[model samples]
Target chain A: MTSQPEQGGGQAESLTRLTEQLSRLPGIGPRSAQRLAYHVIRAPKEETRELAEALLGVIETVRFCSICQNVTQTDPCPRCALPVEDQSIICVVEEPLDVVAIERSGAFKGRYHVLHGLLSPMDGVTPENLRIRELIERLRDDTVKEVIIATNPSMEGEVTAMYVQGLIAPLGVRVTRLARGLPSGSDLEFADAVTVARALEGRQEF
Target chain B: MSAIRVTKLSLTHFRNYAAQDFQPADGVTVLAGDNGQGKTNLLESLFILATGHSHRADTDREVIGWSAAREPIPYSRIAADVTAGDGRERVLELVMQLAPRGQAGEPTAVAERTIGPSGLRGGTLQKGYKVNGVRQRSASSVGDLAVVLAGPEEVDLFAGPPADRRRAIDSTALQTDAEYARELRRYERLVTQRNAALRDARERGSTQRTEDMRLWEQELIRAGALLLGHRITMIDVLQKEMLAAHTEFTGRTGHLALEYRSTVDIAGNGGASPDLQQSLADALEGAWGRDSATATTSVGPHRDDLRVVSGDVDLGVYGSRGQQRTAALALVIAQSAYIGQQLGDEPVILLDDPLSELDADRRERVLRHCLTPGRQVLITTADVELIPAEVRSHAAMYTVKNGRIEAA
Candidate 1:
């Protein structure tokens, strides 16, 4: 016997397609996507039309930074281009949220680069999977004084930080891990603002 | 092969279901509705059909419709039809009927679940169960059918408090191993008994009577150690799967990890098996005197947590809500894959708005990696615009409004 499609195409086919697509995104699932889709369907025409336009607009306009690979509306995100910040230190992070966390601490006046992800052999994520090459290129500049490895303290976080630090160590640029006590195996985003600030202030040479 | 498909799940006088039924398509059924729209209710019916208990913690009477009139007495029932996975041409119908309102004074209500493999009239009725159908002799004797749900509340599988995460681990492990489940229940009961005995001895001021305490401790150690051992093994398996799945789900090269945080750390000085087991026993024994004085448990796997971290950062603590959700999602998806690998039958996968907190890239990665052939995946969502393009191409859709379901 053929397994029935729980929700078939004929009934809300476009809606299902949208939900399936939405569910495929980072955090939206079938249920949320369905509710959202129906929300759009049942919503006032202008609201849904605006959402549809925004969805398309974001996809069309949003692109990763050429240098940091952070999602951006511009080629090099603000941090990559801003001249007011110290260009000597380049803070490396796994995701864009880490950038926000570091920025919230107000400790570091340096520029930032987002790697998109870390290296996990078991999960098939490797150096090639992230923006390592872009980082390497950013480091090739002679004026850069330090590279802060702000990756979380998990095994994979350490591995990524170490791998990147090792690659650029020969260049004479300082590579540092965030100071300990932020809790091992925890993400940076949820760290209390003060803890993150302290981790930033206490960075030591790797 | 036929899959058990719940086309219209309407619950009247059912727990939290004020007359609700939502229709879903075959293969990948996505139930997209707001919270409290009887979403879990729909899945509850399926769970009761498979495992014979509502995942909800409420009683049968609580599930009855309070709105029903007084004359006829309110009742509850769940109905579903399945096409056999064995490729049987006939539609299989199953109904679980609850006891009438007047008969439910006892703590446990009797119910009957009838299986009609062919037609509504010809199905066999297994009695002694009330309208709700939980077996009389053993609540679990209801059968070996299973359903697994992945929801946002499970974010703790990676970052919540230890007990929250432990329950998830124990729940899945128990579902698979009956002996493991029994041992867990026994261990919990014995821990209480041992603690009470220690308290009693202490109140009587009998330190010399510690031998009786030792006897209870012995039982505690034996049962507690067994529980810890199963947990250790489960964590080991979960770690390997989590690592592989994290990589696959993120489509990046990041290591995924799972480690059991026991009450006593593994002794670094001794060999693997003997020392670890002894340390666990010691911890459990020590907790009896020390923790009982304080009226709490301080040692054993019950205090342990399975930490899901990526790199050096815990996905639960440092990662964004989105990241934690992804980690949790990966854990469940990987568990399903592992279950499929270990047990040839791919268990039905239930995802309740799994992608609600994720961004676009991570969402697509989950679908591409997690949902595959021979697996029945049920997904629910609230936004149609957030879906990625590829996923939209493959799934069938439906709409649910005010508990009524129809093909969209």
Candidate 2:
């Protein structure tokens, strides 16, 4: 089933290994990986050395922030360290990308806690695999009032938020999910029936 | 239901047929053939073309011709030209081939024994759809062509396992209700995810109410409620039609009730959408302890049953073989009426050897039931003498021999 271009040993073996490693990345196929390898070989020496250094530099310098679990060079991410009007609010997100998405929206003014991953039971991903323990520990005090669960509306994301909500319920902190509805600039006429149904469900008062 | 009439059907490398084009008559078409001469295969292809699924085959790959490997691309196609009640003409196509788009390797099979004989390397058999030559997702093609097949296989519907019964209702809902496919898919996925959560809780030996288990349960409740609501509505429609159909076909006046025995306890067993969701939520919570212990969902639509009862005699459990066969026939006729009532266009009725078990009187009545004008019908029989003279006179007869069909 697997008909690859690797035939000989030594040079061919190393090149095949490189192609396999590169193809392991998301959206990069074996052909694209081989093309990348060829491009790297034709490039200048320092350029190749700089690419290797950049890859290593990220792994060595970057680490998950101890507070919110967002990737950062500092112990506590800048977002976690900054002061806000209300110290009693926390916006929980699934990953660092979610944090960036919410920050770009500028609609939220609370602190953020990145779970780093959603709760996927099928994949054997439990609460222990995520940053739920850290989140519960952060809620130990009565300082935080409301926790806005900014997880995506996917099934896994919904379960993860609900799990966090269940834990936070006893803590007396309020839990809320992001509203789901139609997209901006899209006509209601062209929207699919499910989208229209959800938009009607999440409709706000005029 | 929009009345659908299949004008022309073309099969290329399909099971038993290397290539065959057939034009069925408007009212009735009877396919006559001896056993194993591809009589049922014709009806099966029509079913696949109509519903995008084969009711008999365990896998869609089985429908691909064994000689399909001789073709350059190794693909099987079933295409049909249909006209609706308003005389709107359309073409629908379903193709089964190996490999995903663009990327190509060995044949696409993890372990297909049938494809193995072809000596093609491992490749996956993927099904693709086209509406009027325009690529369309299978989900978007709902209600394009509605079909009700009363085959011997579905006769076991009453005595069949829970999965088969659920699939029967789902199949009907899938073709008639346009929104049903998406909701059903969503509901199944949620059930899987919920089962995973329960299993995770059991594996971890969680002491404080398995983390995120309720969240998934809550999500499943919303989705499951929608599914239950649809099934209840579907059962109501089928119950009404089957009651009349059973009496008319069998000449028995006993009330035939199609009861949807749901796993979750909605307020009235099946209330309005909001009430149904709340009831499902309550039921899930009640079953959580057992569910977490067993690491499986205890209550959901997946565990429901469709009970076919004729005046206290549950056909699945207490009926005789003859009685079960009668009920199955009634159910198929009811499904046809239900699709017609729901879609406004009557579905194309394909009866594949349904008369073998029925006595002479009911056989003629059953054929007369489907002989309604403007409704296209296809009947496959091992012997043409079994068909009533009236039906035989009205039908455009065709003899099928070794996958070959000829007008008789």
Candidate 3:
């Protein structure tokens, strides 16, 4: 019984191929992959074709912006290509997804620089692996007066932000970080003591 | 009074038990069996379920059944149907799977295997915990089942090294207070990361090592202060209860005291005042030179000890074997009382061959204290005669044999 192949292996070649590829995705498990394969099989041909085209299209067309290193079809991403309203400020982030998040808030109309990754020495992700050189090169022009480090509030994220701050500060650019504290709509009772303490310490007057 | 009780316990591939289910009685449940008949294993299953780690076994793989050794992915699970203090029933389950050593693509496995090297022929142990079928941190699941285990090795707690005493206090505090558990985890992680940073500095002789060390020290001080604060507060509470318990059990005129001994000077305006965090931070800063030279943290709660004393004579150092055992029992009993008072729920007491070392009178005293009304207790023994006739008569008795538990 241990030596026998799976019962449906012979008849499920296409399904198996699709499931294997789906399972390789970030959040899709083997069971979810199988479910997704079945979904694709039952869906209309046009829907599956569109899905396949969108996946391939991303890989075929998307390239990192020459200036900010954010994924974009144009050499300079739209954020960098836009007339810089706040040319003196550049908000640095850890990933292109973070750029989307910050942009969604519309709180900052300044330029953006994507690091692509954070500095995690334990995971062999260093400043060399990230686009730190590119960020420093942008800072060398000295047009940006305030570089806002908007990395995630995590150990690796903080370390990367600090490393970038150290590099950019030598170029006379004032470096700042996003405030760390409690999230909005979260009760103080539910928040952990550390977050509460930080929130209290970083409190501001209305 | 409300109490957490185990309504049902089931084990699969755990220790000597291939598969066993037990419905322990509310007041007192006695497990009678000969040695090596899975008697202690039954108590151990309850302990692991409550604490998320084994009290007897050195490694989780040691708890996996021998028959499972040949399987590709050997695993063991212990599940309990626990009724919390509010009468809400939740199933707390702990599953430990043995994976092939050096397996990649699993980061959780990396942290779980920090218990030195695995002895199970290249099988690494990975544990998963669930409360009411929802995946959760093992430490968080401890809130579901609180247990105070008084076993043979507990006697060593008073007489043995500081680590044993620390474990006793930390485990009990962890079950009762969730914040303490989280701080302990954060403190441990910070220590590991700081040590790695120290090692990296030593290897490279980096000039920025001091700056890096300072940053790590600040974070460590923050986490360490919380841990030290919790441990000291817990020790104060345990001290009072332990004194009460010692007097009740031994009926001795001598006074019993518990002191929280720390490497850092937590005296005067230190631990007792608002300057506790400042004191800890100052101590870390002062020790930076020495710590940098040694490449290890020199002062913190990790280096602290719980000193048990009777009229100025330390029980850990000067007490006789029996006296030490009694002190250990008193401490365990105090922990149970402490948990009961703090959580408004009495923790289930597990006595694993606790009477074997005590004299008849002392054993009776221990049993009387444990068998008090409104408390759930489980006692495992090789000889049924060791249990008092009064307890034997009122208690539900089960005989464990060959990995099976049957009502006697």
Candidate 4:
């Protein structure tokens, strides 16, 4: 009887581990896990099997765009994978929000790469703490025209923009700072959509 | 010989004062008063005259009096006579009018601007430094005049986080050396960008982008190490001085130590070194997995904590109440000593009834050792008995009651 109980315990432990892993994803909590677990339990047996197959499909298929580092189900996320719309221009921004900000402006039909954060040394963030390598990589291509640095006009933002500008100056591509009229020390996410669009329109070279 | 002295000072319609004047003696002048009796306000005005900035960060409106009865608006003015290093006497005045806000946002001034030897409009607040009735672009010309204040807020040095201590240390360091502050500002900006980038990597679910992460890590290590080095050096000096002060005040034989506990494991790095850089790089790579798991920075000096300890016990924990007060006092005295050593003049010590927390034995020891010669000290207290007889005899005394200051 004890040997049989041990056999059942191994299966229960594996199930618990999976539940914990699922709950760890953003916006998923323990209660959500219970709901999801029940969904798996009560679904049509074939459909439940299909859901596991789909999960495995994504795990096997998704990869980062080699150029922009954006996640995609295919190589070179759709935006970066597309050809020669305008190879000369690149917009550098802090996050995907900034990418959205510039895209929504309907100006600068160029490409974009996101640097996640600004330099905040007190909080132990430095230039190496950001995605500046890929940015420098973008600079290596001579046809890449103006790199509009769309970092927020914060101290950290300005420092990052300056650091990146300094690193790529030898590459001879035009490095530019986003115009200052945008309010200082504010996150790009909070800026009114119109302000974000205009800032992009009026970017100036560093 | 001291370069500057405030010989006679007066205020009319100034914060909490209807009218007041004082003829400061040579060296130490202790201003005694209770809380809400306008002692700090009085000192603040003197500081404003010396440096254009108000130590109090509140807006100008709070500096003025507020009345609800549709009464006449109040006026805030400070007049001081200063003797320069060259033996020249100059009279400077600052005046601002206050008006009660109406239902609308408009405000009216009760008085116009005035400053002198001769009246001039807003001349006192020129861009950099004021001259003999002229404006100059350099505070360097204002000579080596400086003040160090140790009020209740400095308690944040120990009780508050590293950022608080960093700011406090940096502010004092800035006053003596402007270049250090500039480097700090540049370094701080870099950290923000680096952290934001790390956050984006997590949100985007791309840990394979090691090149991008590596770029930020390099810059972060460079800037972070510089700041860490400066802070560590400052803390080392501060620790030695503070421990001595703590012993004198508390008469305790226990050992006191200051530790800069960095979150990043750069123990032997000493800030800028190839090995340290590599260690940080390796740490960043390791932390990448965790950063993606939780879209927040998990490692680095930003999460650093500076600890003050007596033997094995953390001061914040097992230390007695008396030990805590003495530690607080020691920290301020240490800061003051650092400023004094750096600038060649002891900071003017302002004690706002700090003795209220101390027993008689400890209070006496504090007065004897902490109040060194050749330093300007101002202590405010309602209980006159707590003040040592030696201090009372040599000190310039003032009494404050009902917002009125009178010579004692």
TM-score of chain A of 3: 0.86
Candidate 3 clashing pairs? none
Per-candidate DockQ vs. reference:
0.01, 0.20, 0.07, 0.03
**Per-candidate iRMSD:** 22.1, 7.0, 9.3, 24.5
| Residues B114-178, model 1: lDDT tens digits | 21231111112222222133222222311133456677666445666666676666656665665
**Model 2 chain B — which ten-residue stretch has the worst lDDT?**
B105-114
Q: Kindly give the stretch of ten consecutive residues in candidate 4 chain B with the minimal lDDT sum.
A: B118-127
Runs in model 4 lying further than 4 Å from the true structure: A1-206, B1-24, B42-146, B153-164, B187-222, B269-302, B401-404
Lowest-sum lDDT 10-residue window in model 1 chain B: B106-115
Candidate 2 vs candidate 4, TM-score winner? 2
Computed on C-alpha atoms, the DockQ of candidate 2 is 0.20
lDDT of 3 by residue, B217-324 (tens): 666788788888888778888888888888878877568888898877777463446566787887777877777677787788887898888888998899899988
Q: Report the lDDT of model 3 for residue A27.
A: 47
RMSD of each: 27.8, 5.9, 7.6, 17.5
Higher-ranked by TM-score: 1 or 4: 4
Residue B172, candidate 2: C-alpha displacement in angstroms = 1.8
lDDT of 1 at B49: 49
| Residue-level lDDT for B139 in candidate 4 | 31
TM-score, chain A only, candidate 1, equals: 0.80
